[model samples]
Target: MLKIDSIKFDDEKMDNDRLNNYIKKSEDAVEIFVDLLKMDGQEEVVGMIALDNDHRLIGVLELMRGGDTFQKIGTDDLFYLALRLDADSIILAQSKADGLKVSKEDYQFNEFLIEEADKFRINIHDNLIISGRDYISIS
Candidate 1:
């Protein structure tokens, strides 16, 4: 099982850069395993999320092309996956609010159900999802 501590953050707490930093720092490589999804009653590549090496979800990643690949490079790959699921906007907003400052790039994550809330740009609702994911707290 990969403990949260084991998975250290490179930038601020929830900065999207953590993903990139994790790949470079962790001695144990990151492995991606996406489930085959189905519209109703057909076998597909988009299904439940899982983990590798004893099966413990340290964090989340993108699901692309029926099978999960060892994500080594590119934000586009994750963006593509979000695009596939239609949750890009939320991801982009959250990633931005959480990602690093000095480093910036093309806005990503335009998939998933989108909505608005008080300054806290969140995708999931019913409660503040980014309670701890905030890297910079604007006061």
Candidate 2:
């Protein structure tokens, strides 16, 4: 089983009740995503929010971190972790220096994730690109 500490969100506690209440919509998920990134102090991070069948929070995964320009997300590791966690759906979020802009690669990756999720029997809820205090949903 994966422990919450495995994802290490700085010192902020992962309040299960609050997170569950705040994750019902994409807007709420974006807020949580921004908060998590701010807490982690990462300029560029690719992360995933995993949810169970009923959309309850399972856990969050910090997939990869890189330079402000770009971060590569490993599909194999991502899907393997999702399967291990038994996630029914996932929301992808990435922080970029380019504010609220979804790059071509981001679109391609989101499309690919949707296609791959079908095979994995997992739902791709949304893909968000966040910068500073703003975000744009691409998928």
Candidate 3:
């Protein structure tokens, strides 16, 4: 059996904020990632923004952290997290410190995710490349 721990945003060691809106668009997903996942714009960080069927926030998980090159995401852990969260969909994000442009590897990974997510019956909303304070949706 696998047990997952829950962390409250208001926990003493962590800051908290109230989000009153559902993630209706790519920009909404970008806002959540930028505010919560502070990428230094120096390393490659890949994460998933899990959303419920109503498009409301469920949770965010940093799936993999890599240096300045592409890193393969672990589908086992990724799918497990999504299933545990009961996520209806997820938005994939990666940090490209050099620029906000999507790389060929990015597209390939996105394509691979789409196929994997389909098998899991989870939707892939978008694939975003985040660089510094800017982001572009590659999906």
TM-scores of all models?
0.21, 0.78, 0.79
- Please list the Cα RMSD from the true structure of every candidate, rounded to 1 decimal place: 15.4, 5.4, 5.4
**Candidate models: Cα lDDT each:** 0.25, 0.69, 0.72
lDDT of 2 by residue, 80-139 (tens): 888888888888888875456666877888888889889889888777887755677888
lDDT of 1 by residue, 91-121 (tens): 1111122223322222121112222212223
Score candidate 1 by lDDT. 0.25
Poorly placed runs, candidate 1 (over 4 Å): 1-72, 92-134, 137-139
Candidate 2 regions off by >4 Å?
1-18, 39-42, 68-71
lDDT of 3 by residue, 1-139 (tens): 1122343333222222334336667766666666666664677887788878877667887776777434565776787788898989988788866777766877887788888898999998877888876788877
Error of 3 at 6 (Å): 9.5
Ranking by TM-score: 3, 2, 1
Instruction: Report how far residue 107 has shifted in candidate 3, in Å.
Output: 1.2
Best by lDDT: 3
